[model samples]
Target chain A: EPLGLGRPATPEEVAVWDIDIRPDGLGLPEGSGDVATGDGIYTEKCSACHGVFGEGAGRWPVLAGGQGSLTDARPVKTVGSYWPYLSTVFDYVHRAMPFGDAQSLTDDEVYAITAYLLYLNDEVDDDFVLSSENFAEARLPNEDGFKPDDRMEVEFPAFSEEPCMTDCKPEVEITMRAAVLDVTPEETAAKEAAEKAEAETPEPAAEEAASEATTEEAPATEEAPATEEAAAPEEAPAEAPVEVAEAPAADPAMIKAGSKVFRKCKSCHQIGAKAKNRVGPVLNGIVDGPAGAVDGFRYSKAMEAAAEEGLVWSHDELSAFLADPKGYMKGTKMSFRGVRKEEDIEALIAYLRDASE
Target chain B: QDDPAIAIKPWMQELGDGVDVSPYGMPSPYEEDVKRRTVEWLTADPVSSINFTPIHALDGTITPNGICFERHHSGVAKVDPAEHRLMINGLVDRELVFTMEDLMRFPRENHVYFLECAANSGMEWRGSQLNGVQFTHGMIHNVQYTGIPLRLLLEEAGVQAEGKWLLAEGADAAGMSRSIPMEKALDDCLVAFKMNGEALRPEQGYPVRLVVPGWEGNMWVKWLRRLEVGDQPWHHREETSKYTDLLDDGTARRFTWEMDAKSVVTSPSPQAPITHGPGPTVLTGLAWSGRGTIPRVDVTIDGGITWHEARMSGPSTPKALHRFYYDFEWDGSPLLVQSRAHDSTGYVQPTKDQLREMRGLNSIYHNNGIQTWAVDADGKAENVEIS
Candidate 1:
């Protein structure tokens, strides 16, 4: 079959990707799931992100105990203090897990959630059961704690010699400092809600490419969510756009409230007609269009100097930049914090003109 | 200052936009802060998270396939390379699948390498928390891939001498999988489907992936759907629960897969700080090595007292990414910097107390230490750890 270039793969295409399991039990499938039927199918599909005792629920993945915390100081590593293979806990809960519902379980619900994650890490006994003929009597307490990789016999002979070039260190000291434990990522709450919509009125913010040298200024006692995004619009649906100019851009309840304000602009804009550009642009005809038109969208330099001072988006400049996109774009990298109910910016420009028709 | 190129601005009195204005072109909204960022509380979202790779705003050693670093798990699967396929199957001998025009009829090749991320600089193995070189050594990138040679598709579906592991599997939604062996999938694995020469992006795995050259970017995998083969090694959840390693008397390491000789610096770093001050700077960085090329690096602007040798620049290839530089002249004091690398098998890189006196502070996957920064004489910087 040398260079035969792809063809055979039958047996129902190798039983749909031969699932994968290894560690001495070699793909153990036939069935049998216990530990009280994996605590009732892990409380109906992994207790909303693995918690009802696999005690994890927040940043997911914890699947029980950290037994003798592998040199603790915050070492949790889980799957009963760092898995060495219960066939990678029933092949990662039968391939990929319950997070966004992957491979939907069931090889006896991944052997009853790997026998209830080995009875929540006490290595079994919630009335065991597990099958594939006693999967070689389970095994995992760090199955001889691995070994393999020796970093070329302990770190390539202490970092292979010939290094020192002049005095080679006698005093330098620092110890540590990410801004003295300041933990990087700041973007100052979207630059203090675009500096409170530039003090509420002479607007233009949508993060006008954030920089008044913003090296962190976020704690103005975190002004209660930028004072409710500069006083949350106080009801002025401004005469509901005169009954939305006689409704009918397929007004399915204003395109279902512009498809629920397009889940906050589909996490960085994208519209219909197979909308492309993300992190903003691709409105498919960016409402009342013109300014920095979207062909391969790379706008902002104050939106290409307001599209070279011509601009457009009319309808009252697209309802004053959807009621305050950084007070109306004074340098928009658009971190969105606008459209505060001017009737959901007239139902998101009537769902972006009924999704660009 | 007033001559600014004798002011003929507006891009020489404008008329731009029309080379079919973007049939597919991007970057240059002033390189929008050269993206690929993340650390939104590290991970619990953005679909099995991981982002990093601005590499303090890139330069030289490839990377830019729109700022490299991604590491999905269940996200960017977009697929549809004409409904992708691949397959292969356990202990093969005759079980294939292919498509994507049967792997564009084999015989391709290319190479370049450097995938990294056996947790690249894993949060400085418990010390100097992330401060940029795009979060302490942005996961890692280096590109130029192309494809085929997984020993010409395991010699076109015929392996079996008790296989000896392979696994792979990806088609996303966290179907990640890993295993690998079989003599590193017949040495230098590939299957790629282009990279630095386009085709393959939907978050870097559009039509295919799985490179593994010098191993470990979670064994390359990407949207790569299935491979199988076997006779051991699966222990999946990315190799016995997350790329093993763990050392310091609790034991772990397991298939550690190369990637050692590190380096970093990237412009007075901490988001390229020294915005040109204190005379003739230059500096730069990157170096690499999954066990090859990076012939040498060593910088140090006065932290380890005085070292130098840098200037490596572009293509040194073997398991890719090299770049280097050094220039220097700055006298504005307060420096520190660092670098290190080496590797054309002479290894040398270590430090962070020689990897915490041999793997201890909870071996959060490989680390590659020797980083440092400090800078400050107003040329900013920070992320320290010196010794």
Candidate 2:
């Protein structure tokens, strides 16, 4: 209003633009097309694609029935199930129906088709006159089903005018629980590993062979420590003398190989410098730390219960979990299928001992 | 005439294995840029609402099958084309059914047409929120459709004299359907089976979709399946709750189908900034009507201060796209560009303010007023309302 503008659009500008329609049924031209008239127009023009009585034909979409079944597995949402208004049917039909010959409908025919569509959806009874005059009073069934989303009200509050800092909240609570491991789909892992393996095999075949041989030796050495511990309990006197004599001579090659196998546990358990708690508890201190005891990470109910019963991540406890993650801790979200190979499990345990210590 | 034709690469060189690779085919390499346009922040949920079809990116006549705009109240139906069946009961003279094979038995015809949503550009009535023309005007598509006429199919069923309305239903889990009048059915309705001389793409109803030329896209139900004839109208939810327009007086408009004549300049608009320099600038746009073929389109460079008749190109099919061009010399001055269209019946496109005045601002559907594009001397276009 502040800036001076030219005069309003002229009558001629308005005359060329007479196709507008109002929802109150105002500006609706004088004419009527009822259910009966619409039926005739429909059978002759629409039934081929839409089907007779608004049930669609073939791969063509059906247009009628299944009302009041919105929550059902298969909602029969035609114009009846989901349409919010009757005027859309009439307006759309009048402008485009019979496919390819749009706007061919006269004002009266559109009204008649509108009336017929209502009759088919069972929204109107017989003798319903859907003319421009009485069009405004008609109400649809799902009128209350829709309401504008008020997310803006809640979302707007989240974005505050004040700058946020550390004191935004005194404490953060962990109400819901989640897993420690990032489980990947078989296909995704296979694809990633396949490409990497293919490239690695072609260029550095000898290096890969050497690593594989070292990996085999590392698992054997890892099991020697576990075997000695188990034998020590069985023969206390004899095992003490044997362990004291052979402990210094334990296989170092197996330990070196086992350390490389720690990558599998890296996502859930951590090791070395800057290794904090993750989905699972930190492995750096797990050799002596109580089971499921990580500073911030929440453990599964099974793991927590195990820790309450005096279970610790000893070599035996760790071996059973490494064999089968989900089986060892039921209800845990860790989806890992487990290490099937015996040697790989040994390698992983040896690697964990070297890293955890 | 500086007309340059790009070399058409054969299918072998372009698509690799061609039709054999896919039981269904795809768009050519030349049309790689044409695709369904979308906005990430437009709606909170992806399944609830999606914007599609770059109507501005397409040229000539047909909207290639791969890029047809799709909007489903429910998700797109994943129906097996083989198990597809159509039943016609209700008040018909005789209850009949047809399979996908049976539908092919009827004689078919081909025609080029455009399907546009009534809500296309409805968001821009108050103010333009979207930047690209694809998002603003992407809810429309033009295709050379192939189908059997509805009249022949009705004759096969032997419609009872009392049968007045035919309710068409889809086999989708949503059971998407709409009520169609008998008169419009016999007049010009076609049970379209193919688009652009190819089988209907799975996204555009696969086997068949009702082709209601010049009508709102909703009535042209995709994945069609059943038909019930009745003597009364069906007040389906789509008709009453969704598509109806509400006026300022709190009363709602009903049964107002048929897209009024409308036109919009596609290229050199905001989404498509004018790249070529000033000399002999070719300004192109599209015009159409549900009423009939678009007769003429007037382009105004100085914001409707003056107008010039644009040259109509290609075949002027009813309810189909008509490309219009206005060649002019540009002096690199700021220009407020707009296009106005007239149908065969002399109906002209209205301005934004005039439409808002008459309809009273509350209506969400059926806004076919003239669209204005403000172009700077730098050739950047912006959607503007002309007072």
Given candidate 1, what's the lDDT at residue A50? 60
User: lDDT by residue for model 1 over A1-357, one digit each (tens)?
Assistant: 596777897797677677877778877789988976787788778867665666455465656666777775445677888787787778777777776677788798888878877876767655678988887788888788888988888777777988788987688878766665554684657758956877886644533323221222211110011111122132112112223334444566876686677667664566665566644677766667788888876565677788889898866898898778766885465635587778778877876776665
Per-residue lDDT tens digits of candidate 1, residues B20-57?
68888887798777888777655556777787888887
Residues B286-371, model 2: lDDT tens digits: 88888799878888777666678889999997888899999899888777677888787666777666566665554557677667
lDDT of 1 at A157: 79
lDDT of residue B152 for candidate 2: 75
TM-score of chain B as predicted in candidate 2: 0.91
DockQ of each: 0.25, 0.02
Per-prediction TM-score, please?
0.31, 0.52
Query: Which candidate achieves the best lDDT against the true structure?
Result: 1
